[model samples]
Target chain A: MVFICSVATAQLPINWIDPLNEGVLQGRLADNDITGYNRLPDSVKSVVREPVWALGTNNAGVYVNFKTNAKEIQVRYTVSGALDMPHMPKTGVSGLDLYASNNNGEWYWTPGDYRFKDTITYSFGPVKENSHRIYRLYLPLYNTVTWMEIGVSSDATIEFQKEEESPIIIYGTSIAQGGCASRPGLAWSNLLGRALNTPVINLGFSGNGRLEKPIIDLIANTPSRVIILDCLPNLTGVTPENTERIDSLIQAAVYQLRASQPNTPIVLTDHSSGFNKNILDETDNTLYEQTTQAGLASFEKLKQAGVKNLYHLRNADIALDINSTVDYAHPNDFGMVKISDAYQRLIEQFLR
Target chain B: MVFICSVATAQLPINWIDPLNEGVLQGRLADNDITGYNRLPDSVKSVVREPVWALGTNNAGVYVNFKTNAKEIQVRYTVSGALDMPHMPKTGVSGLDLYASNNNGEWYWTPGDYRFKDTITYSFGPVKENSHRIYRLYLPLYNTVTWMEIGVSSDATIEFQKEEESPIIIYGTSIAQGGCASRPGLAWSNLLGRALNTPVINLGFSGNGRLEKPIIDLIANTPSRVIILDCLPNLTGVTPENTERIDSLIQAAVYQLRASQPNTPIVLTDHSSGFNKNILDETDNTLYEQTTQAGLASFEKLKQAGVKNLYHLRNADIALDINSTVDYAHPNDFGMVKISDAYQRLIEQFLR
Candidate 1:
């Protein structure tokens, strides 16, 4: 095992694994798709529905019975990304749905029902935690999935050392919060999590997402693999002064975070679509472009000043065209998918 | 004066002659343009600072200054379209700004301001009671400038007489309640009012727009030129049964309203965009498309059943593309302008 040391004198073991470059395979499949059954047994359905009705999780578990014989496996996923959070369900939703195939072709089911909770750890059957070959984890929500730490066993024969838990943090306004996602899993962030197979923390506030210091301070405390900054749509009619202030605020936050976690990656994102068109001359487009450019410049300046982990996602033509929007500015689900896919690609290519 | 009594019992008088459309000639100077003057006077600057602070009947005095001998004029404005009776500001904002001018330069300007307290007659200038020759009503906050009734003084003069004072009524969820319009004038309904140069009573209840019978009843009591329905976006995961129930509720309301205002126009609008492209498959798109088609069919039934004034704004391509949206659903300012412009064009051609 390689132990990395931080530049700051604070003595803490640093587990720095390159999330962007590492060989990680993450994905998800719905229960019915995997199990070929639409409804769980009445008893299981009652149990699942009990919690579902008590408190809806944006992406809640849809039970699946695995029927495979693979031996050992590792899994990763992101819980949330750029989707709106308020609309996402909070309690009663389990993160991952894990199923195993013990008696092939015979019915595969859990021995007993487990109550949903914020955190839980478990080992299945006689299989060593590290040696279990075939397993599945159900992810029914977006934005709240914090980490994809591996489940391990003490036995040396079955090696299951949890990977470094550095998360991708998304910061933005309502869209980041998961607005209009009919279900939690449908949010782009969750979709991205399914695509990249990594843990993600959603920090998207509804209308309160301004690049303020307090929020930044909270974010800096998190051990993040990457930080995505997407704001400005909420700052409509914002003048240069306010934009400058926000830029500086972001810069200060990044610097503070860097002081603690030196090479943690940071990616700055701009407001997508709607504001780029020439609806009323170039005023709206110019301002949006200027603010975005200024933000990128600030990030670049930080990089020049020796902040090694910083990048920016430039405005894309697909996101700027008129057809990209549902109304004018807000992305429809299609747009969300496009953005999420873009972020995932960028992170894989650059931050990794 | 020609008072043509039609088959409908409502007996609405139609004198559809618009001054702005009568080759009245517009000037190069726009209302909001900053050309010619390097800087505005202190008073103008101060007023511009709180452009939308004062509104409704109480602040009618402020709009008086917009009247000038200029051919075209532009003004920054904001107006709340939510009805005053059940006084509450909707969660989102909507508005617009545009330049209005007359070629003769003889048009009188008296920043006309008035609130709709119950009902009040609006006559511009000293052209006697209902004798204005050519009047242009500019609603900056509403992003609409329309020509009101003309030709009360002479037969050759173009005239627009309000036979019935029923306004164009809108019913829907948050979008209908005016989400993220930057200002009030940009709302599609408000823009429609400006295009028609007529009074519009907004009954948009934010999240509470559920197509309830009471709301339909409330709208039915008022005199209305048309009814615009846009509500599916708010019904996120409603079951087919609920959708049918809502549709029935709308039909009931329409039935009652048509019974009273027989020939009044009715326009039904469907959800713009919601399907996230990444997750979009044949099933989801088919479901959404089917819902919209069903909605259109229901509206058409009313038209076929002796309702001559019924229309439907097709859903395909009506909403700005998913990319233009700020989130997956709500429209940004640019999206709002696009939608409003589309409605304006549609109404112009249809109402003609």
Candidate 2:
């Protein structure tokens, strides 16, 4: 192994590698028609709603894996939208998050300093250790990666690592899409994937993850160890105005998935909101109450029908509080960790 | 009590009230020379370093307190700098964070939807209930507030609330200045203040909070319940290149404060970094180790000199980890909470 003695010499020749050519991309839906680093295949453009199609262009759950001995690494990529949302930081919306495993195989984040522009650049460490190590780079949670290239020192060796198979698949709303995590890696789904030592396919559509038949059909088609439905946030309303519609949507989604993958475990999660605790804000409290009750009722109905491997997770189990969210609707890194802990407790059994 | 019953109507006549006129602004260093919502008095502009003087213009610890019966409250304000930094969000840097105390005196965050532009606007609820309640609005943690106005409904009542006196004062660096909190209220100092039901004077100068005698003298002059020193991050380097300088700075700061206020509790916080746990990154580990050791040595030296009420807080107690930081240097909301817990535990006794 070659060791670069100093971090002071930052002018060392950098060798760029395309992650796609290296076969290091993970959490990408397997499709020949996928033209770039999009969450959905190009073929789905006509099949889904225009909003879903546009959001699909985001690189939400996508990541890349590789092994290298380079003391320092760099990434240059472009994002399609404004770098940030009003509540979310540019780091979570459009920047890269990197983690490396030590010799003991424990994963830890590699701190990076980044610059934002038409083409964003992130530089990660003069790590100072000469041993070859595995690295995972999580892509932007709420933005599209138009193109990306990884750079390593000229003398360092780099190789692609294969992804773990039979991923855990999550179909949910903006929270699942990593609405307001401080960084992409702090997203609950990514945290779960790392902790469980498995892969995850996040089908979290921002503001658009209603329990629709078309999306359910897509999820059923994907092979996975377990499937999670966390779309109650998008389906339930404040007054129970469409309780019947919500129940129908839930039943339809479950039935569709059961038809295609009868043995795969299905987990339904209730909406977790701190608004439920508010005594003064009736509207906020009502929304949380109606949504959670609707979700619980659907789980009970499905269980009575003798649906095997069906599970229910209460809102309380998810562990969200007023202090944990960014905009009272989305989880921050601390809330993400709590949600990840809840999922790991229930889903780790299936992964094992 | 008059209440506007509808949120649908956006054209309700608003009664704009200047917080300065109502005597509601808190956390400003007391001096007749102060002109606006700056943390430091204008008298220090020519006394400190240019960068230190400039950072003092930021409204890091400043907040507004009032009791309002308005169903909805709105703020229109202008900030002096760009809305955000690379790792931090605009919400924490430039947006206002609001909290309301319920009838039982328990404080809870009042969620607000915001629009960012030349004059940033934030709207907080047509809160269905119409009781007069106390509200605290935390200002931007990393931006200078040029001008601000709070608007309530024409028929509503708004009254100024006096701030708690003898605040716990913290003199430190970027973390103490609230670098990467998702919102202004989540800053460790803000969180501690709210939790303790006390006021906080945050004398945190971003990138320039070295323990210089000029700033220490300013802090010494300020009457406080407890004084905390968290400037080790700004003073320490990757290597022990300036160990003697760090020691002298700490000794001088402590001596200067002791000379003025002999009995007030002085707490010194060590640098908290997850890099200390990394097995592969020697540069990161070295930086963490050397800084932490330097801080501990100073604390030991001070204690050996029979300095009464001089306390030292270990780096481990700060509760930061790899997952807690945004860019490894600045703590996110999660890390901020942890650090707040540590400070609350250490300082609560003196406060009581």
> Against the true structure, what is each candidate's TM-score?
0.36, 0.94
- Per-residue CA lDDT of model 2 for B193-310, tens digit only, reads 8888888888888999898777887788888788999998887675556788888898999999999999889999888674455433456667766887888898999999999998
How well is each residue in A20-75 modelled by candidate 2, as lDDT tens digits?
67666788666467767877778778789999888888888888878888888899
Q: Which candidate gets the maximum TM-score versus the true structure? A: 2
B1-352: candidate 1 lDDT, tens digit per residue = 1334445334224333343343322211111322221111122333332321122111110111122322212222223343221011111221122212233322222211122322212222222222322333323222122223222222223322221334566776555544544334445554455556545555444455566655565566656666777766654343677557656865876787788778777777766653433211233344555566557667777777766677777655465643233333445444555566666666666665
Q: Least lDDT summed over 10 consecutive residues: which range in candidate 1 chain B?
A: B56-65
Error of 1 at A254 (Å): 11
The CA lDDT at A237 in model 1 is: 42
Candidate 1's displacement at residue A343, Å, is 3.7
Each prediction's RMSD over C-alphas, in Å, is: 21.0, 3.3
Candidate 1 overall Cα lDDT vs. reference? 0.44
Clashes of each: 76, 0
